[model samples]
Target: MESSKIVKALSTVMDPNTGQDLITANMVLHLKVDAPNVSFTLQLPKLDADYKQQLNFACQEAILEVYPEANVHVHMQNPAATAAAGQGSGGPKTNNPLPHVRNIIAVASGKGGVGKSTVAVNLALALQELGGTVGLLDADVYGPSAPTMLGLQGQKPKVERVYGKPKIKPLFAYGMPVMSTGFVVEPEQAVVLRGPRLAGIIRQFFEETIWPPLDYLVVDLPPGTGDVQLTLVQTVPVTGAVLVTTPQEVALADAVKAMNMFFLDSVNVPVLGVVENMSYFTPAELPDNKYYLFGKGGGKTLAKKSQSMLLGEIPLVQSIREGGDEGKPAFVNKEDQVTREAWMKVAKNVARQVAIRNELLPETRRVEMK
Candidate 1:
């Protein structure tokens, strides 16, 4: 009978593709209760032009089970319009509006399951540890895993008025603010987004989310150099990118594609460097022994071939994965030398590259057009 309990329960209902629940997906909006007379609105993103009726029926069925006698309503809207409406006034109405964020660094991978999101989460946390205001944007629309990785699966962004306009207040973890598309949809709903729709969602992540003054905003892009990646590169003035790869030939090939995507004429974001994740596995008993589980130096070789720096090599450790799953990033584990040192190396190298890029690059206003 407790409204909070019901809300909490509903938040656990995750969308299958994104691994994020409906409440965090922003699907369940405007919940109200007058004693037992409860009321709420469910906003479902229109995934297909022909599935309006199907979506409506699905929403109705989903709501009735939880709120038996409660009044419920479902609405369908274009994803672009929905995203635009979320961004408040005084914010940039243009395609790219996050002007305050000094550096936009995309943490990308050529393929999935190479610990891309893990690299992104730790890198952002490591940057925050270095005393800068950091924000993490989970732009992996297909599989928005930041919510679970950051331990914010059940949290909802609070709404606030900025200049009389509604703004989405990003959720925080260990002082870093974060926003994810996973924060907006149900698990069962398909994320069947086309190129234009994907672009609109990324645009909304910048415009709608109320990101405070930040020195760096690390974007955790979806794996692959696909439509979503292309859209973000074209739309956001990405200052640089950090390519992540496992020590494997297949992963290295894909990582190369990811790097080349940035070099494309349409998407000219600078390639900051490369990070080699799970570079080696070290057992606690024999700390000195290095086991190349995925093959050694693939990332280093790739970086050398591309004429980019090999930022750092992170060892495979159980705690790194555990920490990510538990919402406490391994970078914060100062007591654990392996985890701490590994992340610190990666963080320092990334920071140094960012500094060098800022100093050597032309002023934002004076940079020559392609």
Candidate 2:
């Protein structure tokens, strides 16, 4: 019995979680064939007894159909643990809510009305354009812009049962998975939640959402630091933050405060870079002229203070505001080459910064409660 034939047979076995074959999902590993004895390790997202038993039985039958008299031994293990072991991160840490995501980028602002959500929606799309599987989490319960910006307003994500456990299926927008409170709650209703209740909703988004494996999960945070920000740092190992601020002195102070929260000893998430939104205004007719309506160099000043790079400057273009209100994002507009390139540059800088952070710094740990 050749190993290729055994692999081919296993490929026919589907993973109910993702509706992909075991081989295609890269769940099967360590195929060791010794005559009539055939054994392999199966990577699983969940290790429920019934689910495991069902998969084990299916694997045996599939192999048996191909090569009769073959004794199949299937060992099941969590892929999350295997991934950590391979990366040399030994021992158990705080339970990570997003183990499948390589990086969690917090696109934050010091205050509102600075185009933070715009930066986030476009940044996620830009990352996808650069060949990375990305997802978006609009963590701003008070004002969830993903629904409108991604043209998914009034649409709710489906809750499906996986392995007898309920999971929230993320809504897709421009080929990226997205989760936002705007999906489930009315604009006015979202503001009624208090303290723990708010945290619980945020926790649900992190733990219950059935997000596909992604290279980056860009989280669009509410302006300023509060329950949502704290919940995020404590929930997952945030790779870094991208602070968005307008090119003005007033916004700089608020941006610094937000950046300082991440810099706290307890929460040591690195500042990837700073994005200056509305850095200048350029009318459609006067494309080459840059009007510094919001002042100059606030992004650079913030970056200098944070000891991070000035990722890029996004001009106050009419199309950006129009796109946001019209349920369409500027990043998806193919004809807008200038806006497209700007977002792509920010995404490229973010990706490079993430690579540098991962190389020079140790993996971030959850902010433990004292």
Per TM-score, the best of the predicted structures is 2
Candidate 1 lDDT over 1-370, as tens digits, reads 5678557756755332223356766666777656555556645433454344544454455555776665555545444445556886532223235545778889999999888898898899888888878999999888888888888886788876533345677888888889987777764567998888887888767766767667899999999988777767656677888999999999999989888877776556778899999999988678899999899988888788667799889889888888888877788778788778788788888889989988998523212234
Q: Residue 206 in candidate 2 has what lDDT?
A: 81
Model 2 Cα lDDT, one tens digit per residue, 154-173: 89899886545677899998
| Model 2 stretches with alpha carbons more than 4 Å out | 1-22, 33-38, 43-72, 76-94, 188-190
Q: Candidate 1, 144: how far from true, in Å?
A: 1.5
lDDT against the true structure, each candidate: 0.75, 0.88
lDDT of 1: 0.75
Residue pairs that clash (backbone atoms under 3 angstroms), model 1? 14-187, 15-186, 15-187, 16-187, 24-183, 25-183, 25-184, 25-185, 26-184
